[model samples]
Target: MHLGKKKAFIFIAIACVCAGVFFALKTSNNTVKISYDPNDGSSKTTTKTVYSKQGQTVQDLLKNNGYSVDKDLYYYSTSLADQASKIHNVRIVKKANGVITIGDKKIRYSSVQKTISDLLDEKNIKINKDDIVTPGTSTLLTSKIKNINVVRVTKAQVASSEDIPYQTEVVADSNVTQGSSKVEQSGQNGQKTVVSEAVYHNGVLVSEKVKSTSVKTEPVKMKVSLNPSDIAANTSSRGSTSSISSVDSSNASSTSSSQASTSTDSAGKSTAATIGDNTSKSKGVAEIKDDSKSATVKDTTQKSETSTKAPDSSNTSNNQAASSASESSNNASMTETSKKSDENSNTSEKSDSSTITKTSTVNIPFKTCNVYVSNLAKGTTQITTQGVNGEKTVTTEMTYKDGNLVSQKEISSTITKQPVTQVVAVGTKEEQTTTQSTDSNQSGTTATSASTSSSSASAPSSSSGNTQSSLSQYVSQTKNVTYNHKTENISASDFDFLCAVVSQEDNSGYEGALAVISCIMNRADSGKWGGSTAVSVVKAEGQFSAYGDGNYTKYLNGKSSAAVQAAVKDCVYGGVRNHSYYSFQAKAKTTKSVKIGGNYYQ
Candidate 1:
């Protein structure tokens, strides 16, 4: 028994030695080399060869070795949780191959392309040296990146010629008759050459800056004379008129203070001449008095007469005879003077008694209209049609006393040009909202917040789905109608007409209704089809199927659903929009057409 025990011990020792050798071989075979690189601009790398046990992963190896890595860094060769079986070389680096947009194109570049510059070379997207690139050419491509914009910048010096319009100048001239005027100088358009640097983005003109401008031809100013009649024709009842007339040198010194005249009598005293019924004596009183001081002046009826004082009653008979001869000569001279004065008085009465009437033009202000647009940003406005003032003809009668303004009144006014309405497009496009939830195990607070955000987002999504369902159900029950109704932009009547059209044409709910309204709004903003208003666009002939067929009129008479009414109002006033189409048919017939609801919009 002792001999048997010795032999068994030796055999067991050898078997144990063989089992240890096999275990060492298996351990060495499962060993892996791990290299930790911070890769943060510093060339520091740590390499380690660890004996991996069965079922042990790379993540566990890192934990046991106390090697803490960045959260963004990961195993370059394989997954961290994967078994480290026969791993030759393991590295830590940031992951790549995320989606990124370059201009309008999207690409998910491979990790092999390292940088944006390298990716562009691989994709064969050539960019000019002056072209702008977002981020940087040396920037590394990774999952954190979202977009890459490449702006193609091209510049050119362009010379273009433009015509300069001439300006008109009006000059008031009394020599130009009341109704007659002449253009002193005729106007001619001039030319100018402008040198500018034009910038283009992706073959589309973006900006142009003028470097210099040279006048090819100088513009001429138009000189015109003002007509005096225009002032009288445009007279208002509250305004006055002043007559302007050219007078001869003989009457230039005459004053219009009064009609009576003063004279020195034979007694060396001043006498005031009074006007009478005698036409000959009444004309030019000063001249008649100077002609003969001793002669007796008589009225037309011979009932009144005036004679200068007898030249000093103490004079001798010879003196009296000489005085008598002088009186006869003076009387003859007075008679001739009276005839001349009578002729002048008749001419003055003819001019003073007549009234002149004139006709002129005035401007009328245009009305402004507000239109909603879905594509434009809120609070922004664009003028689609310019406001033009209208013209109207006004006639007035003016009366003047002497050579001064007396009174004026408006006679009549008629519209010559109709005022054009101003159309302004008000932006109503709402900003889109996006919900993002990110989870992280490193912080409990972050994870909790992410969960809360995710739940909050779900509520809105569910409510939106329910609302959509309700709209769909309401539209399906309604039918199209054909009738006409007049409406204005943003007015109560406009709201009614919009609702009727939406309910009649669309059976797809809010989306369909919005599409119809958008089309109408687009047409109205363009002012091309029918008119520049929502009401006019909808009621246009052959524009909508429901109008003029009696069905639309019936719908208008009845009440529209609350949902349909809300959609119409929101689109017209609140700025809700879906499609910016002007016309629609049963199906899409062109490449520019888009299908919405039951029709194609273009």
Candidate 2:
């Protein structure tokens, strides 16, 4: 038969030149466009373009737009024609002059409530009456060109995990395995978040980040909240009594709006001062880890890393839970072992089991979280911004071991900026360990004294995970500041009792109060109040969690009571020489952190 039709015309011209050189180099490097409609009630302009062939995705245009981008939005379907085209594409088009479009959004309705379940149960719009809506709302509507596209349905955030299962402690020549640090991996968050995303056409907030972020099954590192300079026996209970008795350069601008005569170092002990900062110059990095692995010790002493995640966190407050499983398998790898005279700076050899092995990073320097990230959906958020809406793209993730943070993550990428409403992480810093192990093959010097006793047990693995020597307990903390003396007006009544009782029940916004103001600015108020500037102005608004936002809703609607009496008449009239450190809230009863001191500053 003519030689089998010339070998089927050379296998149909090599499958049409390998499908025309893969769709002409994937349609000139991807064009991207997909969105469709047609389950019998089809309308909202009936999208369904779905282009990307030979590869095809936007996750196959969301399994052909019946939805399933994973990490959250799911509904696979048994295909009763995709559950009757997802119930006639979620119907609701009423209009006998009272306008009600639903999908493109017209709203103003009246008669027949047209089905998508009587227009989301007569416009309350909650849906879940056992979901499923098709043009069979009794299949009536004759024309409005077929409306039905108001799909607000959302649900994705159920990926949470924490295994950390790999930690060995043989190190005998007197405890040696030391180099590594990062071991971070805060994944396993189905802490679900769909605030909005049913199919936005233009504004573009369509999220679907479901890689599920794995690989922590056995990574271990869990230090614990301690850095008031590492607690030298917490100097008389983390010291500092703020008593400046004299730099009264007229009471030093009278504490720019009363944190309670908030400034006193000429002798009384307020600690630090100077708040001229127009800010700018804070490269932002609460913790990505490693600015040369800091913490050579100087932590000063304080320990309290409380992370309830907002008391189970609001509706799962950005959903963060997955960190209690630990077998502790630390392969520990940060190999520095230096003494370089300079053989071309030790060439670069050591990470090559044939590549791909990155799981150790300990940049350590955090000693500054007072647990404060208050209603901050505006600008200046680090670990990458998230003031929330009005400006979005908020992504979050956390999983540190040896340095503390076993779990806490947020995922909402695109990373928006400047419309911050609320996000306050006041203070947090925990890397406490009390290790003290020693016993290996009952040592008696064999083989060059076993490599100098494993190089002096790995040159002091920075207190080797707190070695447990003296009943090992590094830091466990709780700090409180509550200066009281007042018939009121102690600086506009102490900045309205610290903007209404301690910035609202002491924020869950997180930061652990800047590690209790860095263990009260590295301790020893030498006669009290080290280096001064009002303890460096609330330690720079307790480590600046993006200062403030949306006028914090005019300081939460009370229209910021005349900006808290112009910040207590600009801290009692120096108009706050160069804005004496800001961030003071109002509308109070008592939250606590007042200053005046012992018998009202004597």
Candidate 3:
């Protein structure tokens, strides 16, 4: 009984010690309740109870457990160890990772960066100010931002050359033959150096800007001369007239002489004349010299006896009357001859014989005759003989009726000097072609002795058979040339604008006008005052002085001369005379600017 009682006491004491140790362990350890919701949106909560010492952190507890805490996730209590004495509830949220693409490179990152800029900084990627970013640097880095694109932008200057073609100008020439043309000046291409700034995005060209342009060489205009059809026809007519004159020389001379003789005879025989004296019983014939030349008179009358028987008072009166009548008739005859001679001397034509009774000396003009010849150059004149004035003495016969002169006549004419014929040679040689041949040995070597014969012949002469044709009114010379510069194509409106500006600004000459055009083009290429286009540069406000008062507008609407157009073309295609010059004005006293055309430029 004593041994049984001792064993029971020892068991009760050991059980009491084990119960105290369990109570101490339950009070010392802490319980952490972790709650999390899956991203699947299910209304279910996951609870995790972690038992640890009061000093253990949430991060430590999560790491110790199989649950990993994402860096991008949120935890309700980050410092659980400090709050362990007060609370034990811990909440955590899962965050998604995002992809960023930067200039063909892709990267995966968490949302911890908060912003794109921060993300880039963390990745150590640099971007230029001009670079393009799909997601702005200030944008928040969230799961919604799945893609981030970065484009590298760059600028570069590119240079190249383009050719400018020359223009053609036509001029009318009457001297050139019809249906033909001549090139006075040949056309040449011009050169232009173009500088452009190119914009590149991600190593690909996106856009280009014109930086500057310069003309290396100017184009040379082509000049062509054309003849009118009418001029050619006129020249042919002149040739034919010259030929006819040569063939009809002799006939013309003979006809001229016959006309002169016939005219003289008709004048002399204009009227009939007779000479008479005062005595009734006797008729007297008198001869007079006329101014035309020599003259003679003939009278048909029988000699009659004078009255011898005397009467008383009646007879005395009759005798007195007869004596008075005879005296009056003689006086009248002499007066009439004098008047006729005066008229003949003043005028080469014969006077009325019935009214003229006297003659006088006179001078006559000599005639000119032409003789044509062939086989000589046209417009050639040879004076075979010289003409001199002739003097002539004229005689006339007169008749009196009732004591008054009634008729008169001229008998002959004498020439002191004769007229001469003029001789002229005309060209009849038509333009012809001849060919000749020459023999030459290709090698400088002697051949073996051999019999050789040669013969000479003369060509037969042939006439041109009076065939005539006109010659060209003008002569044309042609030339061809290659340009040293290149050229570029331009719109018609732009070209017209250039032409108008040049015409108004520099009407001095082609060279001066071209200088003005060059200045404007230079300004356009400079990219300073105005736009790069020609029209923009020219129309720039306050740039061209002509545009100040709307004059430039007027000029643009007006017609431009061919010369100005040609000059503008040359300048547009070619480079400026001095590429450095950008301003020009009318010539003045100042010497700061260089002179070109009539204007000064700097």
Candidate 4:
């Protein structure tokens, strides 16, 4: 047993020596040379010598070495880990979760995404082209990055409408009374449609703009008639004759005579002395006759001896004159003889006399005069004083012979009411010019006010506000004016030209139309190819292709389409997209260029 023990001790000694040699070789083979890069902010690198057995991972190795490493930083090379002769290169870094700030919200995330864009897409966060972003989406994520910011932006189109007031027209009528007016037609309000674009950031409105306006209905003009009554009253105050004859007559005559015949006794001898007595009575009468045509006188006599004879025509005139003197005596003798001769016959003589006279009267009228007033405006007339009429009376005497008028003579003259002249005022002042101002608000509405001052030549200092007062006093004198809802800075002609150019250039669709207009505006702003104004830019020689083809002038005469007009308005008001493309060609393809409709822009 001692011999076996001594042999066992020697063998044990050899076994112990072999075991020490194997352990030394295994320990040497397990040794690993590691170089770690923290990749934090510090530039210092770490080197470590670790002993690891086969089938051990990099994470296990680091943990065994008492080194804490983030999961994101554990990496190892397969060739270095598998080959005992090669140096092992391992790296460890500090990493953090991505912090995203979108508007007012914050989100923490840990993802394997390579870029900010990939991270946002993975989180389903959307962004618009106009939205603002910090650390752009394509930027690579690193340990230095702690936060990402996104500003949400939204664009929209808003449409609204406003009322367009109608105007009144006044017409003058001479027959109508002053201070009175009659409405011929009632006025009606018109309608206009407005389109606007609104921009919002984080649910709050930031900016708004008008895109276009369209007239939906036309206004009906109000018509009124005015007249003055003074002219009619003055015409009616101005002024305009009727005669009779009669006759009456009475007459009476008487005559008596006595005679003795002694002629026969004287011739017979002295026997005639024997006394013989005789008695006779005679009477004569005259009568006058008057008629409308002629006058005549007649005589009749009675005697004791009577003889029947016809009167001669030559003695008629003399007899008529002589009969006028003894007219009464003859009439009385004839009456007594007729009564004595024919008491039972019932006959009697008649006498007559006639006289006639005539008279007359006359009338007159009124007048008007004019007075001028220099303070009043032209086409104005006023009556200061009214007119009155006058009258005159005239009398005349007329005589008639043989029942016919023969002579006339003035007897008296009289004055009635006297005439008064009319007074009128006519205006003779020059026309005055007025200035107007318009203001606009955020609601896209406008208000206008006006002020006026008359010229120095005809108006006094007191009449400085006449034009403004007249506008208020006579509201019916207002005229219609065209207004642009989008932009007031551009003139009507320039706006119209832009619309025409856009319509002619791109009538296929609205997008292309807007693109064409943007090009024109870009040229205007560039100040190289054309003038600054929109009109000057469009009409510049050999600029727009449409103008060179003679299509621009033809389209300008007509109305533009609604889409084209809206595009023009938006561009003018800065509602369209901005571009540096100043030229376009048809069917051309090139890099860094965009194609819209049928044209290529660069």
Q: Estimate each model's TM-score.
A: 0.33, 0.16, 0.30, 0.28
lDDT string, candidate 3, 386-419, tens digits: 3344444443334333334443344334443332
User: Model-by-model lDDT, in order?
Assistant: 0.51, 0.27, 0.48, 0.49
Candidate 1 lDDT, tens digit per residue, 485-531?
22223544555567777766663445566678778877887888887
Could you say which candidate leads in TM-score?
A: 1
Best by lDDT: 1
Q: Give the backbone clash total of model 4.
A: 20
By lDDT rank, best first, the candidates go: 1, 4, 3, 2
Q: Which residues of candidate 1, in runs, are more than 4 Å off?
A: 1-30, 35-49, 53-88, 112-114, 156-159, 169-174, 178-180, 226-522, 525-602
- Between candidates 2 and 4, the one scoring higher on lDDT is 4
Worst 10 residues of 2 by lDDT: 466-475
Candidate 4 structure quality by residue, lDDT tens digits, 534-598: 66788899788676665666445224543455455445542343345888754343676677644
**What's model 2's overall lDDT?**
0.27
lDDT of 3: 0.48
Q: How far out, in Å, is residue 181 in model 2?
A: 11
User: Model 3 shows how many backbone clashes?
Assistant: 36
> On a 0 to 1 TM-score scale, where does candidate 3 land against the true structure?
0.30
